[model samples]
Target: MDILVCVKRVPDTSTNEIEVNDAGTDIERDDLVYSINEWDNYAVEEALQIVDRVGGSVTVAAVGDDESDEVLRRAMAMGVENAMLLSGDAFAGLDGRGVATVLQAAAKTKGIDLILTGAQADDGCAQVGGMLAAMLDQPFASLVNMIEVESDKTLKIGREVEGGEQEISRIELPCVLSIQTGINEPRYVGVRGIRKVASVEIPTMDAAALGLTAEALAPQVERLDYFTPEVGAGAEMLEGSTEEMVAKLIEMLQAKGGMK
Candidate 1:
């Protein structure tokens, strides 16, 4: 099983105080800490575990500028067999479909039997995995929480559905899955691990190398602006004795059409 896991570099929200740039078109990136997206980290770990059991190779790929190499190297440190960086001027400012197109092109260059990606990217629209599957015309399953290797050609996967229920299905090999977090505990990548792969060269591909035409790389969607919406009404604190508070809450709920 040759698996490819899509990853991304994103702002470390926990460590960074994210703010909108003065222009309001994007976040203030200056002086920000960057790291592999939390969800993508889980996907990389899941891919590693799958390869460990099935005796296959795992490759991690990212679509970004030179700054993305760190995220790819981190995955390599986590035991991925390969890492790829998809970058170039032509690849900038791409929307979801555009990203899927680039990844599809890269996947064709490798013998990938399974593709894994986070259910959603921290700074993305959560549409790449499904779109990539559509572009590649492969089977796709999202929100996957469990994976069982039924055979070399098939995989039994568990998905979290509505009402906390799990839906299990058998998907064929060479399919794409958007892995949900909590599927596995990601292994820690310490300084030693990172240093080991720091010097390893990661191959970079551009639109020209991927045979992507200018038209194919064009973004269909455009972001007009990105500003925080105005704050809504403030919350009302129900203060009183427990019984009195319950009565007030019920009255408020009834008045608000939330109850009879």
Candidate 2:
């Protein structure tokens, strides 16, 4: 069984310097720190765990420029067998559909049996995994919280729904799964694993190598601009005795149409 885990390198959200450019609809690259998307890391860990249990190879792949190599190397350091980086100018400024096209091309080349990805990426729209499944003409299950390999060809997955309910599903091989965060505790890179895969070469593939065309890679959506939201002033605190506070709450609610 071969599993392909899709990972993404995103700007660390903790850095206040990271900002999106309004002109090009791209992330402001200056003074930026890159790390794997937290959710996608979980997906990689999950894929590794499954492959470890089932006795197979796990390959981590990413769609980005040269910066994405670090993200793939990180996954390899965590026990993935190999890594692939999909690149090219054609892949730039791609939305969900374009990304899916690239991933589908890579997966097809690898003859992957199962594809795992985060439910959404942090930097861009979160629709790539499902769109990739659609482009590949394969089944997909999103928001997966738990996954069990029932056999070499079947997988049982659990998804979370509203009201704390869960929807369980069983899917055959060659399907896509957009996993939820916290599905498993992602493992830290040990000294040995890091040393072993840190120097491992990551292969690069372009649109031509992946059998993709610029027209076929057109984005389904377009971004106009981006800007930080203006910070609003703090709300006034209404402090008083219990009875007085209740009256003030009623008045405030009425003023805001809560009682209308």
Candidate 3:
């Protein structure tokens, strides 16, 4: 199967009370905890299960600084065969397109047959998987919730569509898929598993090694600023006891034509 799963390390939203930085360009990161992106966990687990059945290797890759090694190692602790860190000065401040370009290069070198990524990262930009596929000139599918390998070269995939429906299609090998969560329950990585791979080395690839120039890695979109949206003034609070509040809520809904 020779699957490559792309993962990311993001702020642990559950633990961190995210606040805007003084500069308003990004979140306040100091003293914040980081972990694998929740959606990426599902993607990695799906890749592992696929390899377990089809007999091949599952490699997890991340685009970040050395600190990202933690997430990669965690993926290793979850039974991934190999991990690679795509990192370098040039990779810094890259946007979604640049990231896809880096992964496209890595995919070529690894002789990968299938590439999997989370439907979206913490950034909520669900563009990488499709962009990587386009850059590689391979078939692509997003929001993939089910995958059934029909043969060495073909796969039957199920995707979620509008109206809460599932769309099933056959996609050939050498393709990329953005895996949706709930596809599988990701396995837990305990302290023992983390310690087991603690000493294992993970390879790192830089822009130069990937034949990428600084200009090539440059981000097209620039963020001018980051500010919290102004709170809008709107509704009235319902008062009185529970029954009265319920009645008031129904009255408002009916007044707004929200109820029959």
Candidate 4:
């Protein structure tokens, strides 16, 4: 049950307002607090749980610059046995496919029994798990919430489908699983774990070492613009006495498709 969980570092947008500075292509990230992506936490915990039951190691990997090392240490604090940082200037501005190519190349060389990652990054652009699986030429599942490793090369997995329904199926191993949140509760890193992480030295691998050429790493799609969505014209506020407010609200609602 040697498991490799791919993780990411993303800005903590919940606490701070994001400002676009790179001509709407990216955010001004220097001042933002960064952490392990929320979805990756679930994936890491699930890997740890499975490895705990089956007896193996869990390695967490991240793709980012120097500051991204913090999140890898954080994952080690969560009990991952090892950490890998896939980084290089060549990795900058990589699209989802480019990233999946890097992860696939690295994983192929290092090797693992199962691969797990969040269904999507907090950046909200891609569902990359399937992309990695496709590149690896293995069975792929997305939005997966449950997993049962029936054997070394077999997995019975469950994924969310339509209308709150769950679809479960069995697939062969050496496959990638895109974890959906709620699969399991992610454990909080305590002081002891944090202290351990502080003393750990995670390895760094340049994308070039992964055998990725600059041309191959180029993004497939280009961003035309990155502007904050405009507020809807119909959104308005009513300020008045309670009776007047109620009347105005009712009128507005009636004008729309609400109660009269």
What range of 10 consecutive residues in model 1 has the weakest lDDT sum?
Answer: 117-126
Query: Candidate 4 at 62: error in angstroms?
Result: 0.8
- Say which prediction, candidate 2 or candidate 4, comes out ahead on lDDT: 2
RMSD of each: 1.6, 2.3, 1.7, 2.5
For model 2 the local lDDT of residue 42 reads 94
CA shift of 118, model 1, Å: 0.8
* Residues 104-124, model 2: lDDT tens digits: 899988778899999888754
**Per-model TM values vs. the true structure:** 0.94, 0.90, 0.94, 0.90
| lDDT values for all models | 0.94, 0.87, 0.94, 0.87
Number of colliding residue pairs in model 2: 0
Put down candidate 3 lDDT per residue, 1-260, tens digits, no spaces.
89999999999999999888999899889999999999899999999999889899999999999999999999999999899999999998989999999999888888899999999998798999999999999999999999999999999999999999999999999899999999999998999999999999899999989998988888998878878898899879889999999999998899999998
Alpha-carbon error at 77 in model 3, in Å?
0.4
TM-score of 4: 0.90
Clash totals in order: 0, 0, 0, 1
Residue 40 of model 2 has an lDDT of: 93
Candidate 4 regions with alpha-carbon error over 4 angstroms: 234-260
List ranges where model 1 is wrong by over 4 Å.
254-260
